[model samples]
Target: MGWVTGVMVYFVVWWTVLFAVLPFGVVPEEAAERESGGWRGTPRSPAIVTKALWTTVVATAVWLVIWYLVNSDWLSFRTGWLAMPA
Candidate 1:
């Protein structure tokens, strides 16, 4: 993929991975805190920095795999059974 396309793909992959990683190692807020006055179901510690770092690592790996597939002949939509009629 070209530089622009690769960047766009990575951006999408990063956001998708972020949502998937957001709930990891989460701790629910205390019952007292929930009853007092606050948003319901808030995590005690969201750990945004840690999650963002992990998202970057995972997204890079995923994007690399996609880049390989698209650049290599191992998998292609324009050939074999995946080809479309002109």
Candidate 2:
């Protein structure tokens, strides 16, 4: 894959990884009041820094794999799924 394609693939992979890593290690806050629980919109500790770090690492690895597949002759993305059988 070219530099531009690699970068684009990495960008998409980064965002995908971010969403996947966002829910890891999430903790819900306990409510003090018995009648009505205070369940806020945000998580107890979002851990943005940790999540971002993991996302970067995961995205890099995923991008490398995809880049290799596209550049290598082992796989061909141009092959059509609907092609008629010989």
Candidate 3:
């Protein structure tokens, strides 16, 4: 259950950041103006690819931080042990 919760939290955080930063990186003022009209232009694939790459990097960084905190005893919980008792 804890692992599931952690995974959900990580996904939420990563997606939220991705959506928030996406506008800054991908939405030029002119592009937004154009989009506001009924005629929407196709997004550049290269930009989408770059955003995915950045999102992956950010997500991995977040995961590593969470993993370190949990493993270093900085974050403790009352749950069934998944590892051999020390």
Alpha-carbon lDDT of model 3: 0.65
Query: Per-residue lDDT tens digits of candidate 1, residues 22-78?
Result: 999998775535457656567878999999999999999999999998887667677
Q: What is the lDDT of candidate 2?
A: 0.81
Please give, for residues 1-86, the per-residue lDDT of candidate 2 as tens digits.
78998888899999999999998999876553435645654477889999999999999999889987777656754554443445
Error of 3 at 60 (Å): 0.7
* Cα displacement (Å) at residue 12, model 3: 1.6
* Candidates 1 and 2, the one with greater lDDT: 1
Error of 3 at 74 (Å): 3.6
lDDT of each: 0.88, 0.81, 0.65
Measured by TM-score, the strongest candidate is 1
Q: What is the descending lDDT order?
A: 1, 2, 3
Q: What is the lDDT of residue 28 in candidate 2?
A: 70
TM-score of each predicted structure versus truth: 0.79, 0.75, 0.53
